[model samples]
Target: MKVRITIMPQAAVLDPAGVATAHALEHLGLHGVSSLRIGKLIELDIEGATEEELHQACRDLLSNPVMEDYCLEVIS
Candidate 1:
C-alpha cells in the first residue's frame, strides 16, 4: 500500500519557520492573511504494515506527540 503522512506543529507550539514564511508572504504583497502554518508530507510504500502499526509509528517516531499533530492516509 501507498501512504501519505502529514505532520505539523500543534497550534499551541511556536513555529519560527511558519512565522518566517508568513512574513515573507506579507513582504510579497499578499495581504489580509489572518493565519499561516507550515507542515511536511511523507510518502511511503509498505508491504504489510497494519493501520494500527502505522499510527503507532507516527506517535512514537514520526511526530512529537506533545508538540505536533499528524494525519496518515492510505492512498493506494
Candidate 2:
C-alpha cells in the first residue's frame, strides 16, 4: 500500500516560511497571491498495512499535535 502524509502548520500557529515565500513571490511580480501556508508531503510504501494502521502511524509519529496537523490518504 502507498501512504501519503501531508503535514501542515496548525491554524493558530505562525508560519514565517510561508510569509517569506509570499513576499518573495510579490517581489518577483507575481501578484494576487494572498496568504500562503507551507507544508510537507511524505510519501511512502507500506507493506501489508490497512488504512486504519496508516492513520494511526500518522497520529503517533508523523505529525506533531501541538503545532502541526496531518492527513493520510491511501493510493493503491
Candidate 3:
C-alpha cells in the first residue's frame, strides 16, 4: 500500500520559513500574494499495515504534538 503523510505547522505557531518566502515573493514583484505557508509531504510504501496503524505512525513519528500536525491517507 501507498501512504501519504502531510505535516503542517499548527495554527497557533509561527512559521518563519513561510513568512520569509512571502517576503521574497513580494520582493520579486509577485503581486497580491497575501500569505504563504510551508509544509511537508511524505510518501511511503508499506506492507501489512492497516489505515489505523498508519495513523498511529503519523501521530508518533511524523508530527510534533506541540507545534505540528499531520494527516495520513492510504492509497492502493
lDDT of 3: 0.87
Best by lDDT: 1
lDDT of 2 by residue, 1-76 (tens): 7778999999899999999999999999999997899989999987987788778888888888889999888877
Cα RMSD, model 2: 1.1
RMSD of each candidate relative to the true structure: 0.7, 1.1, 1.0
Runs of candidate 1 with Cα error greater than 4 angstroms are: none
lDDT of 3 by residue, 1-76 (tens): 8888999998789999999999999999997887788989999999998788888878888887788899788766
TM-score of model number 1: 0.95
Model 2 scores a TM of: 0.90
Worst 10 residues of 3 by lDDT: 67-76
TM-score of each: 0.95, 0.90, 0.91
lDDT of 2 at 67: 92
